[model samples]
Target: MASKLAHPLLHALRAGGPAFGAWLTLPGALSARTAAAASPHLAWLVVDCEHGMTALHPGAGESIAAVAALGPRAPSTIVRIPATGACADGSAGWQIKYALDQGARGVLVPMVSTGAQAKSVVAAARFPPQGVRGFGSPFTQHAWGADVTPGEYLAHANDAVLVLVQIETRDGVANLDEILAVDGLDGVFIGPYDLSLALGLPPPSPDPHPEAETVIQTILAKAHAAGKKWSVPLRLSFRSLPRPNPVTNCRDLLHRGTQAAKRAKEGFDMVNVTSDSGAMSDGIAR
Candidate 1:
């Protein structure tokens, strides 16, 4: 097998330490650049095309470039494509290909409820004979942060790109074991809010409800047992708060940061600090 290219996010996960990241929801490079420069501790930046303003075509690619251009300190860019699964027509496969071709180091697929769905995600993100992804993007090398030729990129991309699936539904929770059993799936990201809704409970509480907490714990345990990285989105409230209150602003930032740290200490492999919209809104308000 050709040596897979180095990816900072994967390296951090393999290093046995928690990898922190930010979520990008706004559709521009400025927010991405600013958020990526906020803390060198960031290992990845998830461009949220699923629920955010970013689109797969040009928006995701632009934001990815902005984040990846931060040089060595740049966190690996992962595009969360706005699709649920690989439909019969193979729409998910094409979306995954576009995101990868645009230079995303990884792909975050949401609403994966079965092992079969995960298998499709993995296949879409990787190259053959391990997958069905077609190669031919001339600009892909730049997103990878390498200077290799197209052939070199293709030779190792199967292993180089990370494929993460979201476990956010009751069906997903029930099929957790099977999903984790899928080969080539690098990690699982838990969508707490969606998971809560899926469980027929009130939306995300200030703290997760007992039922949600139980589900979260189960997912974390199973992921660790399977030797796969698990991540959670930790939304910060600073953006939602009324600004002009320096003390309150500081307190909120500190509180959110602490919560993220606590999650990491509790064994989450990755934690999202904040999103582009959150940071930008907070910055503008300040």
Candidate 2:
């Protein structure tokens, strides 16, 4: 039997296929309309606090709250917390835990610079022996249901939680091997804009400088060797709207998929939707 796209992108990465996707911001407070917009494409949605989307409020970030609100609507939720003192203090990490407790499948730590940061992020995603995330559901994450069990949730989470570390700096690229060597990391998401800036190039440069690009490919190769996903974030933010194009959302992968298919005619796996945010209906942005 043909294997189904379980955990969609995760399954693709594990099967040595292209793992490409994009981001979505949890706008201020979430509404069902916002949830509906982001429920469509891509294997997962990265609820931004780090970059991509601008912050809508102060105190707690928008990503966590948005996930808490719309998680059930989306197939998989990945919250991106700021990589500042907030996350470094571990408070933001707990917010990530709370988002999971609310139903997020994973967390995306942005501007990840070292293996230590990766370790901390992984630790926060897990419960006890694996790490130290507290258990509290039966809330919106569990839909306030009586049927969800703590024990069951914990056990499943131990194996199912995915941690994606953002790689977007000169140092991050330089230490790519050691960072990928971190035991609990499930994957790395290349943050193209910051990476371009770090390499002393323009902010929106899609074609990475040869050496920098080589570093990125190396990370993907290493991640594949390590049995981990290499998630590339394809956000077409600067472009004007009418704002929904499948090609723009998964740019690099679209190109690679085309070339790969031409070279070998091998098939590729895909998630149910293309990109998970900005879905509109009745001639309005959702």
Per-candidate TM-score against the hidden true structure: 0.91, 0.69
Point out where model 2 deviates above 4 Å.
1-20, 26-41, 52-74, 85-92, 140-147, 237-286
Q: Assess candidate 2 and give its TM-score to the true structure.
A: 0.69
Top lDDT prediction, candidate number: 1
**What is the C-alpha lDDT profile of model 1 across 1-286, one tens digit per residue?**
2333537787888789699998888888887888888887889899999998888898899988887777755888999999984342466888899999998889999998888889888988888888899988888877665566787788778877899999988889999999999899999998877888899986553456788988998899999999899999986555444444666666666777888889999999999988777665556656
In model 2, state the lDDT of residue 47: 57
Q: How does residue 188 of candidate 2 score in lDDT?
A: 82
Error of 1 at 47 (Å): 0.6
lDDT string for model 2 (147-263, tens) is 445555555676666887888887788778778888888878777667877888654333456766666567767777876666655443424235544555355335434443432
lDDT on C-alpha atoms for all candidate structures: 0.83, 0.55
**What lDDT does candidate 2 reach at residue 57?**
35
Which candidate's TM-score is highest? 1
* Worst 10 contiguous positions by lDDT, candidate 2: 265-274
